[model samples]
Target: MDNEILLRLYSIYQKELYLYLYSLCGERQQAEDLLHETFLKALLALPGGHTNMRAWLYMVARNLFYNQRKKKSREILMGEQEYLSEKQTDKDLLEKILEEEKRRELYRAIRKLEQKKQEIILMQYFSGMSQKEIAAVLHITPENVRVLAYRAKKELKKNMEEFQKKSAGREDTK
Candidate 1:
């Protein structure tokens, strides 16, 4: 892309890229650093001309975020003391409790899925990737992506039904 076009793309997409990174890293400073790295890499990789510049930028940013996350995970596994303990104020503690509860519910729902189904569901739904995009990322065909998503949804529905059935049984017992 030309310098002007690249500049425009940077201006338009910088915030979005940072937000995406923030979601991944859950820290503003780290997200800003990642965003800067993404842009720098994009600048180095930019050819004089290319189609789908926006998509290319986003893809680069996403890959950078993923790579950083993987590195952080490895570091944590290697006994890095990354977790910080803090005494939350009342409002913060309340929010944290609510968030923990919601996370528990989400994890329970996800655990109901088979492994492959969970992967497909997370890529398509949580990641907001199109079937084609997911297929590309997963090294599968678009048709297969669609089929997997359908099967995953069906499995989730069945699991939800079973959970409801068990819940009702408990209520009757009570």
Candidate 2:
């Protein structure tokens, strides 16, 4: 696109794009950096023009966020031994402890879901994709998407109930 069009698009969608990236990264700085990087890449590659600029921008940002996450995951796995050997005695210990507890609980609940069900739920709710859009993204029919969403919600509710029961049991023991 021309400079004017690019500038307009940037002004219009920057906040929404940043919000989307923030949701993906769960970090404001990282999201802002990614948003800047996304627009830079878009300017470089798509300067000529784009038929679907909004979708194009989203795809670029999403890909970059996921790529960073994948790299971080690999690095963490490679450093697992070192990480395990480190002692946690710093002032950050309390914050880390609470974060770990919450993460564990969230992970346990997520793990209870089937992979496909989890994907559907995350895409629909977390990614804010419409049912039709989600179906298109997943290469499934809209009817299937609806069915999956319903089933996933039911499964999540069941999992949460189980988690609550276990938590109650632990509290009783305490």
Highest TM-score model number: 2
User: Could you tell me the TM-score of candidate 1?
Assistant: 0.53
The numbered model that scores best in lDDT is 2
Q: What's model 2's lDDT at 114?
A: 74
Clash count list over all predictions: 0, 1
Candidate 2 per-residue lDDT over residues 66-146, each given as its tens digit? 789888884211101113225667656776765666566665565567755665676677567677765654567889989
Candidate 2 — which residues are off by over 4 angstroms?
47-52, 75-123, 135-144
Per-prediction TM-score to the true structure, in the order listed: 0.53, 0.59
Clash pairs of candidate 1? none
